[model samples]
Target: MSEWQQRSLASLGNYENGFAFNELHWSEHGLPIIRIAQITGSQGIVDCFPGVLPESYRIDEGDLIFSWSGTLAVVRWSGGPAWLNQHLFKVVPAAGIDRSFLFHVLQASVAEMGKRTHGSTMKHIKRGELREFSVEIPGNECEQRKIAQVLDTLDTAIRETEALIDKLKAVKQGLLHNLLTRGIDPNGQLRPPQSETPQLYKESPLGWIPREWSYGSLGTWLMGKPKNGYSPQEAGEWTGVQMLGLGCLTKEGFFGAQLKLAPAGDRGLEKALLNDGDLLISRANTRDLVGVVGVYRDIGTPCTYPDLMMRLMPSEETSAEFLQLVLQSSKVRRQIQGSASGTSESMVKISSAIVTGLKVAIPKPDEQSVILCRSKALDAQLQSELQELEVLRAIKAGLMDDLLTGRVRVTPLLKSLQQTAAQTGA
Candidate 1:
């Protein structure tokens, strides 16, 4: 670590708490108001809130904003002047200290400051405590500038990579919507009418589908029944059987590598044991995240689903991959939302009765194979892009931790300090 001078946060800047504006005062024409939710670390501002205030309450550019309650983060201003909400605090750096350097110091102190929080109902970092916090400061402005430049470069890279990942995800979603809704052969050349049921191509429970495709429930093709796993009292050894929880399911699919293991006796696993090709669907969660579906493709290890999940086993006629894709479609998701039962907070619960009653159009066996192959190919391409983005993110995170903490010094950029000292004969 570099030897540095220590100073309290109050000495380097003036901390100003935000003021609350009533909902009636909010207007689109006024200055943008910054909320605690808008502070997203070094990643800069986000469009989380849309409240406005007059120029009197506006905070200038380059001011560091800290979220005092709920979610905490330190954001550096990139846009024009903006106002701060009551839940946020604006720190304006004084003449001697660099604003960007102060932002990094605040970012580095997040963990320690979080520990100082006190309250049972909601966490908070008081203004007094925040102002009293101490941080190391380099004596030379040249050194501060060099350090800030290096850290800012890494932050820029992280933001760029995140933007790229978002674009790729949007592209994948658009492709899925097109391929699933309008079949690949869109020229009307491949689709042919069936002799048995010519008018069957009309509307049904799930919108328009081909006449040859048949509708059936999930339970009709299942060999074993869907069941929930037993709840354990404590965490213990694996005993060769792993217990899958909601955390093991990612937005894309099953995350088998991060599965938590539990003893066989702990899970009370008998008929609820999971097998390869079995489908797992989240039964209860937030409205948008309730019906996530994942197919278990791993074998050689036994696993069981927790109470919040439902398992599906297809019969000889149905393809597990096809069902998995169908369940993930927006049509099924909308139906699941409609069928959900609750008072204020609704949850999608796919019971044995509901699963059996649900209908799906199944393509011919050969056609199903082709669709599965095409879907898998698309998924593989997306996975590769996601992996590359993850690596870039990790690299940026590592660089931030090192450079901002002063563990890594920029010696090459210190030449300016040497020249200044030589001229001053110090």
Candidate 2:
């Protein structure tokens, strides 16, 4: 701890707030202006400034950006050169501080600065409050660089893993589309598309499908009648019963994390109780998310679902896995969206009749099993990458705590690296 020095954020960098450009200043041409919404890198440049702006207001690649208001975040600009909008600060590292290290330091301080935020409606950290936030830094610049390098390496790995996950998702989507439309052959291979082999295809209500496939309403695949879930009032404490939130079901499948507690005195939820491998679908949601289906996996707690969702019991003839895959298909999604009813575009409801009437191209039970196995294989790869991402994130968080606070020294690690390099050179 003696090797580290305590310093305020203000002394570590130049925090320059951006210009407040109005609609009048915006143009369709010229450089894009980055706003708080673009901080996460998900949204693209919406507005632009045609005229030349001051260099201080412009951010190039690798510039540190901090959003001081509503949903505070710190990021190194990798979205190319752009103008920084107001409520965001373009941070520059002080002489002794490493730029990467400073980025990490600010990233770590977001939570503490959030605590000092003022205003009720739009919470924000004042310049004075932001300047007062303190961090511990190593006295030696080399050590700081080394620590930043280690974290940056981890960041690269995390980003790569995330990219892999995204690619897997896309691949899985394509695979599902192919498998659901063209049934697998007895030789355990995906049959070619109708365009390549029309002789093996047949025209169905849903469109061109494999000759062995038959078009039927989803109701034909169900054992028990479709049932809506029960919704209970919010309980302030644990009630021994949990209710699945609408978020529990996603296009990707069931996400068990979004469960809420059922009211303590609530009853008559027995019919709504969810069991393992139960297929659930959103009865009411946005147009895009409505009718999304997922198979529930038990969370080892007494759980019931909300009224916004419905549960389907697959009959002996249907594979719940195969049915779930079919429901997520683009054709079925479009049908669901078309049949959904609501006054607002933000929310829509689907009746059980709509669910039952939607037609699907079904293959034999054996083909369904084969298709499911392929889907599960992709799912297994995706899950592995997702788990790796979580572990990498955890490791990065631990490294930030240890390295930034001087609890873990990077000097020893650096020395070991130098020795290995020297040996390699020899």
User: Model 1 clash pairs?
Assistant: none
Instruction: List the candidates' TM-scores in order.
Output: 0.81, 0.92
In candidate 1, what are the lDDT values of residues 1-426, reduced to their tens digit?
A: 446677776687777778776666566655665776555533444322355444435677777887778766788877677777787778877787788887877887777888888787778888777667887667676777778876776677667767776786787676655445443333422343334444536555666666555566656666677655554543566578777777666567777766666655542666567878778877776667676778886656877777778777777876677778777777777766666655546554556566556566666666666666667877787677678777876765675566555566656535665688699996
lDDT of each: 0.68, 0.90
Off by over 4 Å in 1: 1-3, 40-56, 60-62, 186-202, 210-212, 216-225, 257-261, 264-267, 297-301, 343-348, 412-426
Stretches of model 2 off by over 4 angstroms after superposition: 234-240, 263-267, 414-426
Report the lDDT of model 2 for residue 2.
Answer: 82
